[model samples]
Target: MKKTQYSATRVDIISGHLTEVVDDLRLVDVADYIAFIRCELFGNIADIVNSATELTFYPDTLTFGLGGEYTLDWNTAPKVMLDLEFKNMGVNAYFRLTLGADSTEIDLHHVRFAETGRSPADNTALLAAAFENARLPQLTASENLG
Candidate 1:
């Protein structure tokens, strides 16, 4: 059975409903995903530092939804670090989004989630969780708020 290497486009982003298969994302996909999430949560994707291979978003606050247990207040440590690295893996290229000082990698090359599938709303929730997970530790340590 042949697997599909879906191009990371705006439509793909929307079709996935913001619940992207982290392992199937391209570099641009990561940027678009973040932009989408930010837009959904904060109303717009302004002042977002974007480049060919990287992106940086300094939002005023990172809020989880009504059910979210995590929130990162920007008053103390304003920057929630998210770095995307484009790499050549010999057979193919890989896009990796490394979050925070620990560099916890979210590999978009895995086929697990892509095989199972998730709803658009679920995808959004996943991104939100990833966003929260990325900054929770720092916020917890610096401001003592999680």
Candidate 2:
């Protein structure tokens, strides 16, 4: 199979909203916000590839989703999940961005995800920088990648 190189940038705008709960009760919320953005990026990359390489991304042949666990504390820095996807040949790739363990403040986390089977090396740096620039606030981390 021939290898095609592809790259794209996506942005998501998330709003901050949470329901009230018991004063001392503990809870965990599994938001599909990051998953949604990942799907959008995948679609964008697929479109670009189709236009440039004439290789269509058949829905039946492609699958995209997100799954992860997060913990929120009273004084802990806010968390933002940066999700990305890449597809080439028969391989799919994903990357994530979050507050680094050594990061002092909660800044934008740059997540770079890509799919393999293509010229993965061709635009790796460009794609990495693109995702790095698509940072958002932890509160609006679930916004759709535009």
Candidate 3:
């Protein structure tokens, strides 16, 4: 419950699969969604996560995944989900972010589909969907967090 503040400049995203699509996504929110996720991770640690993140969209599905957990002095780490959707300029994408307990580094993965013809961005008008939820916030570290 710490009062963690957020800034858009903090979250940096580098797309591994489609730079053009990522650029389009940024054009819609101007990186607000990315910043919010970074804010959630930063809230867990006293300082911000300065590590560089490199994520790629699924070649087939065009979906991306990123997750990480911070070590907390407290007994348990909180689990939360933050989902985001962006629709603009013939681009649709979904982001699903989550935070849990016990981890040092962050990992980015491409969500694979069992079917051969599974495309996340099938439509141009808000057709793509990705979800991201981050819950690490140094929940019980400082008194201010309550």
Candidate 4:
């Protein structure tokens, strides 16, 4: 008998829009915080990537201000794959998230800003800062489900 793989579908359970200007080092901090939020929503980075197959939320997770007014179907246009949307010094920013080869690693496949006022170097620096600050959530024993 052959074993069947059980793949899970990921859903857009949460979304956030910037309420304040995020620039300088704050941009990185916000990115890290969002990453932590993702880990909290899912058991791990792998679970988040596998989310395309399944959408499950962690028990008692706090996701304040992350819920958007609308939700897009997983296969519809303007899909709900965006993990973050922020404003950097007034520029509309976004991130498309993906998982790295390592099950524990989460990568931001795309980072785009709606405005074109900043130079390429400035944007790169901002993104690098975000990646540097990104950290996985370290859930407590009680919070960690088997």
Q: If ranked by lDDT, best first, what sequence of candidates would result?
A: 2, 4, 1, 3
Candidate 1 segments whose C-alpha is farther than 4 A from its true place: 1-115, 139-146
| lDDT at position 80, candidate 4 | 24
lDDT of 3 by residue, 27-56 (tens): 323133335445654332211111111232
Model 4: number of backbone collisions: 11
lDDT, model 2: 0.31
Report the lDDT tens digits of candidate 2 across residue range 1-146: 12222223221211110011111011222233334344554453333223322222233222222432233467864453433243333333343324223331111233234444435454454444443333223334456453
* The best candidate in terms of TM-score: 2
**lDDT values, one for every candidate:** 0.30, 0.31, 0.30, 0.31
Model 1 over residues 10-125: C-alpha lDDT tens digits? 12332232223222233233345444555554222222322211221123222111110111365532223232321111111123333332223333432122323676455434
In model 2, the runs with Cα more than 4 Å from the true position are 1-64, 82-84, 88-91, 99-146
Residue 111 lDDT (model 3): 26
Model 4: lDDT to the true structure: 0.31
Q: Report the poorest 10 consecutive residues by lDDT, candidate 3.
A: 1-10
Model 3 TM-score is: 0.22
